[model samples]
Target: MIVIQAKLIFLNQEDKQIVLDLMRRWSSCMKFAYKRLLEGYDRKTLKRDLQGMFDLNSRYVDDAIMKARSTLESARELGKSPKKVIFGGRDLFGKLQKRHINGKAYEKLKIRWQEKRKGNLYSRGDKSKKGNLNTRIEVRKNGTFLRINVGERKYVYARIEAGYKKNKRREELLQEIAESNIPYSVELKLKNGNIYAYFAIEEEYPEIKITKEKGVIGIDINAHPGNISWTEVDEKGNLISYGNMPMPELASGSKDKREYFRWQYAHEIIEIAKKKNKAIVIEELEIKDKGKRGDFSGRKSRRIRHSFSYKSLLSKIKTLAKREGIEVIEVNPSYTSIIGMLKYAPQYMITKDISAAYVIARRGLGLQEEIPDNYMKFLNALTVEELEELKEHVKKTVRNKHLKKKHLREINKAIKFLQSLESEPERVLKPLYGTSFSTYDFWRVLKVAVVTPLSPEKVPRDFSTLKELLIQGKWGDP
Candidate 1:
């Protein structure tokens, strides 16, 4: 179920007000229903009297009542405490947000839709509390142009490209379903003040493949843009691929653009899992950078940390995996990186980050702590010239391609360091190819992952003192 956002455009004030009225009524209905739910009123009781409680059409009233019940029920199942949901819930944008019209309503709202170019059908918040629920719109897709209905049709709606290509993904999904697939749900959203739509098309069911699985892929997320690290492993807990794939890095950009990059990166990781027919594993972090802000706090750091979008990444991967019938496992995130740093980094001559991924994969597989003794075979076999060439390969290929020029001086400094380590940087940082290629703090955090069981949350960002600690062999064999 992929959600697409489009700016719900309004051509006139009257139409906007009409939408506003419908949403207000919807909110009234939700309030009534939620109150009844709290009073121990069952769905039957609420549904029976919903139309009388709100000045809305019967279908709209039914949708509001049923959806409210559903919302409260789901919260209860998840052990969430009951809280009053405000009108146009902050997450739902507006009242019309939960309204779902069946095929009959769609037919009533549309005179005609050119399936090939676009479809003009009217909708309000379909039930969402995000973006801009500016007005109700009949979203069009993939059309050369949009034609506005100025009372020519029964409804006040704007024509748009059937598949708004701003989100090319929506276009693709719409195209895919144009044939014989059934859509599970279609949602309308007020996304960032723009009218957007989410199209969830159901695919044909396939034969069940796994009662149990052997292979697993583990992933670790970083706060910095494009700092995702992952590894693949076999059933025996043997590492299959460590730092073999391109790291997906979001460049410094707009929020929408950054979200899109993270999405594309998830797809790349999913592709690897699909190829291996393995389940996906990732650290199940409930909190991010909790209580870690410092005295020298800066706006940029705060924004970067806050906007990491870990939840979105997990959501995207899970949705994709579900359709493909793959399993996703979330392991405890605490100390996975430290364990990786100690156990797997040296074995594969990779950075602590990738080693963390390796450990995550192993933990999901229910494997023990031991690393394969011969894991270093590939690194040991590489000659000095090959090692230097590999170092340069990362400096140019991965580094130049993934790192943003905004941090060029810092990146160049790190690249120059990699160049200096011509023969063996592994003795210091894990294999440059695996981790430190993108991370600037190879000496500090990675070293902690190397020796200490789990570095204090307040480990100095500066590496000078940390470097001295590492040289003293205070932690691990490294």
Candidate 2:
């Protein structure tokens, strides 16, 4: 049995209430089932010895009895008497049989439960929240519904049901989650700024994969004046072809909305290439220097900057590649964009033409070999007439160097702040200092001071903000 966890985000008060009620009822059912098991005439004490069993052993009826007895003795030593011991339902019990199985089963069951609960809740109410109700349930085919109780409160129960019939919808959601590379865990936590029978599916890590591969492909993300520059290579480290793709009409913001469509196109291309069992090579990008301004002055520049999800795009490519057993590698992007332009002349005029260059460079590198120096030099010298074009290209290449430097400085400052926080032990700053402090403690420290500081709350959020700031800064410090 596998338990998969999911989150259910309710839209309105009514929906929220319905979900809460369902969760409580489900918990009560589990409690009821546990009580039944306790009262059975099996000639064994369920409460006396069950608690002493290891989690796995206690999952079984007979073993639970033995464990309870042992636990009772231990409790006596601490001046406490063992009380009623409740067992989880079949699904929960099966989950406890093994750690890995328990986790997976929990998720599957959670997703399924949330999905079913959503339908039931929606049927009862007309008005909901801003977004559609998102439900996550775990699925385990053989698991039976059960309930458990603790003291006067009954909790932890589930209703078994058939799988959802919407294969396409499920697949689409799964794809979205996968592409986002978001690994989440279901946590029973507060919702809507209040404590309730709500579960939070929190993202554990940024769904991004950074790899070091021999070949490098340059990419210039665009919304207006759309274009991409690419350079391909063969196994012998020889440039095969280089070019760019232009979005001529994009300069006026008409093509701004096409970014998602472009991603879809790129995704399709990658998918087809995957079928041929090929590896993808791309540039390694770090958006550290993005906070600095750029040439695009007005709101249009801001919109263009906001529109590109380069990280997400790269993330999708890596994820799809991994699923298909194709390798995705990143090489120093450095000056790939500029170099691509110089190498592929007529091809560099537009962005779309870059795809041809990408194929050539990918082939030339043939899984091993650094991007050649000549290409880098060519890129360094390549010039663009449009300030937006220059800024975008430079932002992709030179800006990385700035980010790399700032990141190191931030780390040093963060260490001091963390040590101070740790030294003042009784400050009750745990909430202020999140659980995963080590990952982004420095940024968190910065955020406490500013309402909307230059830095963002998280890495991805920061990246987006920084891009805009950088582009905006290009006009003036304001």
**Candidate lDDT values, in order:** 0.51, 0.37
Clashes of 1: 31
Q: Residues 355-385, candidate 1, lDDT per residue (tens digit)? A: 7788888878876653222223222332445
Model 1's TM-score against the true structure: 0.50
How close is every model to the real structure, measured as TM-score? 0.50, 0.34
Report the alpha-carbon TM-score of model 2 versus the true structure: 0.34
lDDT by residue for model 2 over 363-392, one digit each (tens)?
A: 335432232333223222222222223233
Give the root-mean-square deviation of each candidate in angstroms: 16.0, 20.6
